[model samples]
Target: MKHNWTTTKLIAVGAFGVLRVLIWLPFVAINISTSSPLLLIFSFFFFSLISVFSLLTIRQFGTVTIQTFVEWVLELPLPSIAFMPLLFAAAIIRALVVDLLFFFLRTKEAAASIVCGGANSLVLSALTYVVYLVMGIPGTQTIPSAIFTPIGLLLASTVVFDLGSTGGYTGYLVYKKMANTAVMRRIQGAQ
Candidate 1:
């Protein structure tokens, strides 16, 4: 899709991107402090939902804009400096996966949202593991040897896929409600 990056659209992307970071930062901080798996999973859901919402709002290059903004935000903090490269790559990969899926699926319908969300989550998780292995991060071996097995991979994939799709569905519902409002229409230039 050849989208013209008008000033209005650039401003919209910047606005929505800031919104995404504002909403995501607290969750990330909490998850980092607590090291809770449940919080991590919830964060993924929120992340996907927000990304999808931005995509639906912008109607083009939404994921890319938000992901770039997110990486830029992370880069500013000293604590995240070490992980910036990996995080940036993962964010870009996830954005590409979602955008490409949207392109191939050719619709912003619930099903496409679900697939995009699921695929994005799955790719991120896979990349995390790859980074762990390549970087030889501590505690890599204790990830349970079974998880390397085919059955384990399948089970893990299934759970992640379900969580992501559920998130996507939730995002779609939220977008629908928001999109119906006059404020959202004005922001989207649909008015």
Candidate 2:
């Protein structure tokens, strides 16, 4: 696909990227402050909403390349490369999943958003688990723990993704309305 990265589009993408991180920071802090699975789950529900909203905004204003760039910028402050591979993989998978679904299903409804979001999260979570295993970071150590079960983690991630995507779909409709209204007002004013 040919990308038309005009200054306006780039700025919009970058601003949206920063907005994504800003929206997520508070939730991340909350997650860090508590190890409660229930809390995390609840927070994930909200995070999914915010994440999806960000995804929708990005998609509305830019392309997958811009989305991926935003993801990279979000991860730039990480202490190690532990999450880089997973993030990059997520970006590619998200784009492909959305594109393929868009092609076959030929719809941009809530279903598409939910499927794309959950698929992206699941792929990333699964990849992270595999990478963690291969790197031997918590291989034998945490495998015995209840929280470390692969299936549970994957399911949680998937649920979060689904919720977030649904939220994004809802948010897109709202944002588009507001945007259209603003544009109409500006046009009317010029006449």
Candidate 3:
């Protein structure tokens, strides 16, 4: 089906994009200022949450069009050219996992949300390491830092799981409730 441009869709896209930024900006700022990965746990969780939010918002309010993706990219404060590959890769992974859960598996629940969120975290994190490798970023890891890095990352993974599952499950439930309410109202109106 052809999706015509409409004001509501434009608004929804813009709104969600801003919301995603609002949710992420503070943590990102902190991470930048401190130059510390200490907050990486919360950052990943928030990032994954917004990533899932982007997918759900797009699915509900906009067409799966290049324009939609472009709008999202334009709305956010992307870091740099070096980050684009990871960003795009994360988006693709999230989209694929979400599509698989909702379209093919017919899962619109917590499990699906958690899975999508976890996949987003895993893909983004793994890609980040790859970028570091390419850039020759040295790991300043002493033995303790090395030991803690994986532990920290693992803990961050749980954040991804919790937030993703909660957001996905709640968002789907709310959407269903609203849809059902609309249907019921229509039926009543016809009566």
For each candidate, the alpha-carbon lDDT, in order, equals 0.67, 0.49, 0.50
List the lowest-lDDT window of 10 residues for candidate 1.
Answer: 34-43
The alpha-carbon RMSD values of the candidates against the true structure, listed in the order shown, are 3.1, 5.7, 5.9
The best candidate by TM-score is 1
Model 3: which ten-residue window has the lowest total lDDT? 59-68
Model 1, span 51-132: residue lDDT tens: 6666666677555545555546644764542345676676677778788887676474788778877876787677766765
Ranking by lDDT: 1, 3, 2
Model 2, 1-191: lDDT tens digits are 11234455456556655665565566546644553223333333333344444444433423444555675667678543424665466556655554455344334646655665455455444554565566554222433355458986666666666664565465555555654464333322322
Residue pairs in collision within model 1? none
Clashing pairs in 3: none
Measured on C-alpha atoms, candidate 2 has an lDDT of 0.49
Across residues 1-191, which tens digit of lDDT does each residue of candidate 3 receive? 11344455555556555665566567657656775534544655655555454444444322222332553576456663323565566555544554555444333544555665666556555555555556544441211344358787677556656655665555555545554464323322322
Off by over 4 Å in 2: 1-5, 27-62, 78-87, 102-106, 136-158, 183-191
Better of 1 and 3 by lDDT: 1
Q: What's the lDDT for residue 41 in model 2?
A: 36
Model 2 pairs in collision:
48-164
